[model samples]
Target chain A: MATISIEHASKSFGATEVLKDISLDVKDGEFLVLLGASGCGKSTLLNIIAGLEPIAEGTIRLDGEVVNDVHPKNRDIAMVFQSYALYPNMTVERNIAFGLEMRRISKAERKATVREVASMLQIEHLLARKPAQLSGGQRQRVAMGRALVRRPKIFLFDEPLSNLDAKLRGEMRTEIKKLHQSLKATMVYVTHDQIEAMTLADRIAIMKDGVIQQIGTPQEIYSKPANMYVAGFVGAPPMNFVEVDLVKQEDQFGVILPAVLKGEPKNYFLPLPDSKQLETRENTKIILGLRPEMITHNAFTQSTNPEIECDVDLLEPTGADTLCLIRLAGHPAKARVSPLFACDPGESMTFSVDMGRVCLFDGETEELIRL
Target chain B: MANPKTLPGANGKRYLFGRLFIWTLLLAAAVLYLGPIYVVLSTSLKDLAEIRAGALLDLPHELNFTAWREAWSSACIGVRCEGLRPYFLNSVIMSVPSVAISTLIGALSGYALSLFRFRGANIIFALMLFGCFIPFQIVILPMAQTLGYLGIANSITGLIVVHTIYGISFTTLFFRNYYVSVPQELVRAATMDGAGFFRIFWHIMLPLSVPIIVVSVIWQFTQVWNEFLFGASFTSGGSQPVTVALNNLINSTTSVKQYNVDMAAALIAAAPTLVVYIIAGRFFVRGLTAGAVKG
Candidate 1:
């Protein structure tokens, strides 16, 4: 396995710059995912690492060797494309064996390697079939087989599971994770799917507009996002942002949250944890970021957690948990509570707010106010 | 609910009348198209005496093979009594090489143009497309001079060269349009698989090009086979293609015109293309519409 290092890489297509000065390092045998929305240059970075796209400026080193000018073939990298990109004209056996044949491996060895890969992918029966004859999941297996047969130093996947149905995608996701654990091969996967990144990556690099917003473990990114963008982009139902007035009450800093309870206007003061960052920002407007699960029904509360009574504006039942909509500081926000404890819409309900985990961001810059 | 059988009596009668009218028009059109073929077949089977005595549309008194044998063996064309056999061989030699060379070159160029991005690619493709619109009559003089300079003038090779050059523009257009619809990811995957330029082309692009290849082969063959201007202008005597020889045979000023022999010679010259169409006509239609929609 090889470690990939891309330093200050910049790419552009004519006048439009696709990848700005981006630097990233992937550890040996680590599964690193480049996660972002479309047009965020995650795929472009993957292509750059694969040596498929030329970098306008920067150095890319593989295994501590500068391979900026190496061809993709000589780079000893194998890639699985989102479309599978299996040679439609070749049978599965030949498709998986093509790289070995091109490398001038012996015919017998190539056959043995292909057979081994086929069995590993559980596609031995599909060896004689062309790609067109395979189902979506089967084609994905063959694509992986093609990559695995090479035993390359680095494996690149360009959103390989994006084309599969939801159920198939999950099964393949687990299969890929298991493969990674078993093989311990360095892999760089690019996708816009946060769930895939969270489940499959050892560390996820979240990008936006050609810049990396955050690069950390999935839990770190989910719990302590680097900015408003990262905070909003990571979670399902997403993190809620409410504008609040930071006020000082007897040397304890708190945020004034305006809410309507049972059709009556009420202002709640949610105290913030003591921090030098919040001390300097007293009496200033700031954005408070609260994850949905941080606010829950009162039954699952700690005595230390502050409580707020607000009218439930709407209710969205999602099997295990029901997301209730409530106004925080006059802005709508969602709170996750057990479906059993959710109240009907338009009724007042008490919610325990975990102020300890709330993220405070600069109102103007939108950068998180770290505690 | 509105089935024709379930319609009111008046509407049903109107529907039947409309169907009958369309059938009559279709039959008339079919006859108009096939009428000349019937006449040619009848004339080719008639003896000279029968031709003089019977009506043009009448069946021959008996099937006669003399005209066919004469057309194949000894019909005089431009004072050469060796008939269309040599000219037929010349057409075959010219069309086969021309079609194969033009199609191969076009496929390679098409593969490069559609998949590889380089400076001046579109300009080069646009110029090649521009060559397709240039009229054949406009290039005859320059083409003849080039052929004479190459010292292949008045030979099958010279005609092959001319047809191949003229055919490249069209063949390239056909293959380019077809290859453009192919996904670029296939090439990228192959490249990552350690296959280089020509390997990717031979292994991936070519195997996937069957439909377009059939289309190109049929188009170039038909055009080169029936082409008269280049054949007539560039070659003569022994090296002239079948179309030129057929013209010479029909236009020769004999003391008495032999309609049976002329008809037989004409049918012989047209037979190869007719056979090709009959065998591969379905593929030609399929190949034309192959890339019009995504799978």
Candidate 2:
């Protein structure tokens, strides 16, 4: 219902800059997620948007109206904190209705809104209970109900599911997605968990050291990361990086990946897609990034995709897929394979490399090479 | 570690001896502390003749209400024969407002100091803490002059003002430490909920402040009720607190001495504080420890 535009936003604590000159635009009804590890300033960015923290320099516009000095409440936004910051002394009913009360709404109207939100969250039976009496998941639901009761133009969530257990985290993540879909409200969520960001965000902004590395759809970021940092940060058993020599032979550009097969050293040349950018970098070292799923036991249909035999160093079973750690160009790389086709430790396995989806990065800059 | 059943008999004997020694020391300390209360009670119930004839720790021959009545309504302090009655009322009037005003202000100050971030917050807190260590004697002359300038000198109002001002430092210290353990997110959420400063304090901060409130009330009440120097310095005659009256009752020049009346009046003055502690003693310990451990 509202769009957030942050232009040249910068913040610092003492001498250490926590948020550099950051510019981001969140479209109306778009679920934008700021994803990064701790100290990357994702939470600080959320606070700045919430008006809980002030920016050193820059202006924030909501719905194309300047609101740099406006208070958070007047900006028509509600935030769900990671701690579930429900008023410990108030009942679930009051906690949800408190905002309306603060705005001087009538008691009867407040009660009705509380009922509607409680039913939507399936927490009607818990309306009379205090926060102390609820479980972690129940408290999380109450927090969401409180935000929903306000029906603000935008909703801000700061790692709202981080305090829940893994199973509860998954359930609440789905609930949040459902809430966003049903309400079509603008949301800016901050989290360090990549899975949450991947499943929930319409567009993910991956940040590092106060600078945003990439902002794109989950598919775009996963398949085409802007830099080596975004590539490694977004995947589970994260994307593997191997240094290889890019060479041109017979008018074709490819990278030579040294591998160990059955205690013997070998080299596999995986051809790169035709690009003028690749031609200029021939006979030079480049970093090749490959996702685990891209290197699997299944054979590729295309003749261009190369297959390499590798010695499996370790096996990690994750229910449906077992990950086999293998050496690619003398660096340990993870390859995802079906549990049925997975090879045990100290055995040889052939993994087909999907050359079409591989990423090539500059050795010195660590930035992705366009192709 | 050896099991008790497998241990030697000498160890059992040593354990018994140790427990006996500990119990003896504990009992002795308890008697030493309670010994004065026994003397005061016994003396208050005795007539002058019996008090002269009996030992200090001796039990009264029979219960008597004469001295109690005399202390309540008819004893002479200075030139006043109104006993401790009016002075006790003066103390209640002075202490109640002083405790309430000081505690409420302290809670507000504490809430601001602990939760709100502003320029020079730490420096302000440091100054207030410095206020706690300032001796009453050091400020008496200046305070008296200020009270005179304000036209409340030598009255119960002046004493009330004095006690409240002096009590703020300790009460603020107690409440501020307690409020720090509360999460900062609660305030942020309340702010986002459209609750302003006073609204948040009334709904969120005050409700969660019961334990600390009890602590502050007990602390300020006891201090104000027992204070003697300010009560004596700032007030005279009809406006003097019970402590001043009790002093005059015991130390007044008289041939007979009236030991029973002095004992009864002293007990009457100390009774309110004793009762306050007995009722809220458990919470005092709990609140102190609760503030000690940071959340």
Candidate 3:
């Protein structure tokens, strides 16, 4: 296992910069994922680490030794491509042994290693078949087997499961997670699929516009996002934001939401928690970020937490939970409620807001407000 | 469309008539193509008296081997009575080595052009393609002088060099167009696997080149075998190819025109190319169409 440290790596094509001043470190035996949308340069960064693409202005180190000038084969790394990039002319056994053969390993050793990798990937029965004859999932297994036979210091996967169908993708994702667990090899995976990043990464580095926005554990990224982009990108039914004026209500600073129920408008007060950032900010506009699950149908206490009665504009039932859409402060907000709650459209329902889980952000800068 | 095998017997007459029309057209096309070849073969088997007595379309009363035997050993061309044997050997000696050397160089050049990126690569490819548009007659004089400078003038080696140089532009075009369809990722993957330039080419690229090689070989064989201008201008006597020898035999005014011997010698000169085309006909078409559409 190797620790990969990238220091201020920047890349550009012609005049347009594709990666700008990016720095990241992957610990030994750690599974780190670079997550972003298309053209965010995550794939380019992975290529740079794999020595497939050249870096413009920074140094990369593997296990504390500079590898800026090393070739990919000499870097002790193996890569699995998104297209499964299997050699079309070779049989599955030959494809797995190609790297070993290139390294000039003995024929007997190559055959034994091929058998071991095939059995590990459960592709032994497919040894005689060509890549074109295999199905999509089978091709993915052969690709992984080709990488695994080398047992390189690091494994680079470039969206290895994006080509499979939904069910197969999930299955392969779990299989990859298990493979990482058993082997404990350092792997740097690149993908635009957030669910893959959330499920498979030890740490997720969210990127946008060729810059790393945040690098944290999945739980940290999910519960305490660093910026507005991370908050909006990580969750499925994304976090809701409403513009509110911070006002002093009797002894506490809070915001009021205008809710409509039964053709009548009511003002509901949501008191801000005791934080140093909220001091001396009265009469100023701020944004309140709330997750969908935080606002639900359960009412815990009448006096401690704030509750709003609003008309449900839409309901989407996903069998496990139902997402209810309601209007708050003149914008659409989604709230996740249990399917047992049984709410519908055009009806008024009383929902409780989890005041402890709310996040406050600066309206102008879109940065999370914290003490 | 309905399945014809499952159709009723009552529809058989209409199907028969449609097939009959197609067969009639095909028969007319075949005769149109093969009529000249048939005349040459039949003429080569007849005596001078039979030629004067009968129409050109009439079959010989009795087949004669005298014309074939004479063409093989004793037909006269330019003060040499020794038939087409030597000139035929000269063409073979020229074509075999030329095709092999030109095809190897073409494969290497095509591999480099398709896979490697360097300054002015596209300009180089464009320049090579320009060679295809130049007519052979335009370069005959300058080429003869160049052969003289190389000290291979009027020799079989000189003809081989001339054929190889001219044939490279076409063979390179065929292989380059064909290799362009191979994915660049294969090369990248091979590089990452520690396979250098030549290893990847030998193991990965060459195995996949059988069809295009067949196409290149057949094309080069036909062109070099039939080439008369360069052979006549650049060489003399025993070094001239069969095409030039045949031309001299047909036009020689020193002896009475032996039409039977002339026809037999011409057919003998044309046999190798005909055999090549017949053997590699399918691969030739496949390689041509694939190179055109994909590249």
Give me the runs in candidate 3 sitting further than 4 Å from their true place: A258-267, A280-284, A299-303, B1-30, B291-295
Native contacts retained per candidate?
Answer: 0.73, 0.65, 0.29
What local lDDT does model 2 show for residue A126?
100
Question: How many clashing residue pairs appear in each of the predictions shown?
Answer: 0, 0, 0
For model 3, the docking class works out as: acceptable
TM-score of chain B of each: 0.95, 0.95, 0.90
Supply the TM-score for candidate 1.
0.98
Residue-wise C-alpha lDDT for candidate 2, range B1-295, written one tens digit per residue: 7687776764677879988999999999999999999999999999999998859889999998789899988898898888899999999999999999999999999999999967788889889999899999999999999999999999999998998898899888988899888888999999999998899999998988888888999999999999999988888899999999999888874788888888999999999988988999888888888853221
Candidate 1 residue lDDT tens string, A315-346: 99999899999988778899999999999999
lDDT tens per residue, model 2, A1-371: 59999999999998999999999999999999999999999999999999999878999999999888999889999999988889988999999999999999999999999999999999999999989999999999999999999899999999999999999898889999998999999999999999999999999999998999999999999999999999999999899999999998778899999989998889998888889998678789999999998899855346557889989989999999999999888788899998989888999998888999999999999999989
The digit string of per-residue lDDT tens for model 1 on B145-211 reads 9999999999999999888888888888998899898988899999999999999999888989988
